[model samples]
Target: MTRYDFLPRLVALPGVYRPQADTRLLAAALTQEPLRSGAKVVEIGTGTGALALQAAARGADVTAIDVAWPAVLAARLNGWRHRLPVRVRHGDFEARTQGLRFDLALANPPYVPSPDARLPTRGARRAWDAGTDGRAVLDRICEAAPSLLRPGGVLLMVHSGMCGVEKTLELLGREGMSGQVTERALVPWGPVLRSRRAWLRNQGLAGDSHEQEELVIVRAQKS
Candidate 1:
């Protein structure tokens, strides 16, 4: 079997459906912030628990949630491998978390539109599709985030630039919150390349192999 078929392989899968340069960049951004040792942190869609593990490594108390059972198991194993303390749980981001509030929340939710989507493993449907416009998951998270966060808490999320960044800003504004782009980068959309390339070829841009995906990291704060 290929390495990807191994249980440990899940830990190496991309957190986002596509390659996300900004997601890794957000890790650096988190390092620069005032993340006190043992600060409470909650991560939504904790694929492979990469970000959550990073936070835990910095001595932060972290709870990571994912709808995918295999991903959760993989994350737990990854945490074990690194000797990091991160609680990986199978849960939905839109649901309330047992009255728990956190100092920091992070999510790299699925922001890809349907029709051109790749199915996550059977256990990860909610982790991948964001509905027709690709904002269903994000909308729910934004709506629920204010309640999940403590006063002065922050929520960090990464999404595609094509997923309507301006609209996201507007939604956060309506939620009585504010956000700023902490990082942005161009990365290849390896997940949808087959469909994307087909569409490009149909439009007579076949030779234009410069198709790129944009990654935007936004940090929102509840007033």
Candidate 2:
């Protein structure tokens, strides 16, 4: 029932994407959703189930998915420890969400721009390595959102401005949803971003002395 105090109750296994600034921003946006009982929610790319727990605490029926088994375990354990009704699953989101229709969907997927066009197939890198332009996963989510959402359902996703906020809005628009950045925060570069700082600068995603990246939460709702 505590906010931003999940670390102690959460089961932090290796390779799991720990709750970070992006998680907090997306969770903050989630709190604005209608989370009354009977509301169905699906969270793609759930890490430790932070957002899922938040939604469940508000009375929404929350189901969360993560590709990593350890992450799934962690998420489930966190929900159990907190006595929240969050269903955590380990599998590819595309497969897990099949035939699923929800009143709300949430995601804080990997949007870090990497040097390679191919995304990581396994390991810790899978949590942050998006393609060179960083839209590999985001594009897929945009394509799948419409199908996953029920009428009047909404999707809230967070990503770095480096991935092009306008582009995300455009993709969601194409999905027949009205979308926009609803929340933004300037976050100092994390370890991963710091490690890729030089390449990011070369790609013009980062400026000289610009150690911060703007994170945005895009909210899309089906009319």
Candidate 3:
């Protein structure tokens, strides 16, 4: 068997965010969990349904939501391609899944801090570019996590350290949710960060000499 035989073959459309190091890192952490068959799982920002497929492959009932129409289509196609049953939704997580809770919540949201104050409504950048502080999407996830998860449910979210991991923990903590960093990795700066080097330095999120950033996976559980 080749590597990643477990995951479905994915086809990310043009302008859709493709899986990268961060995606693999989250998937690795996910595999370690004792996921039972038919567990309810919801993946936010399910670009190409990568993580959603991961859960489905393990026999979990999964629902994947994406804000971009192209991503929704890609995810549905990938699910069909592999014969995995994933309910693909077209909308943001909080809005689309309101009043619903899941056994597991997964997110790999836009955490890259962009110079622009407004988030991109259209373009591939929407998949990666958060607002100036990079918390535009991360903050929303932290706030919505408690509501999205059921009692004893777990949230597995990945984001760049530039957005403030402690802040994520703090936001969850305010909601009485307990959280801790389960994984961390330093990855070399990618094209996006390289282009924003000067701005990131200006915002004090990165150093002029820094060449890498930490990607953190936080596992938070509801009581």
Candidate 2 off by > 4 Å: 5-8
Model 1 alpha-carbon drift over 4 Å, by segment? 1-22, 116-126, 197-210
Instruction: Report the Cα RMSD per candidate.
Output: 5.6, 1.3, 1.5
The model with the greater lDDT, 2 or 3, is: 3
Q: Give the Cα error of residue 55 in candidate 1, in Å.
A: 0.4
Predictions in order: lDDT: 0.73, 0.88, 0.91
Candidate 3 residue-wise lDDT, 13-70, digit = tens: 9998888889988998898877899999999999989999989988999999999999
**Per-residue alpha-carbon lDDT of candidate 2 for residues 1-223, written as tens digits (9 for 90 to 100):** 5456664466778888888889888878876766668799999988888888888888889899998887899888888889988988889898998888999999999899999898877788888889998999999999999999999999999999999999999999998999988999998888988998889899988898999899999999998
TM value for model 1: 0.82
Best by TM-score: 3
Question: Would you list the rank order by lDDT, best first?
Answer: 3, 2, 1
**Residue range 103-195, candidate 1, lDDT tens digits:** 999888877665544544563355556655578778888788788889899988888776788888888878887888888888876665446
In candidate 1, what residue range of length 10 has the lowest lDDT sum? 1-10
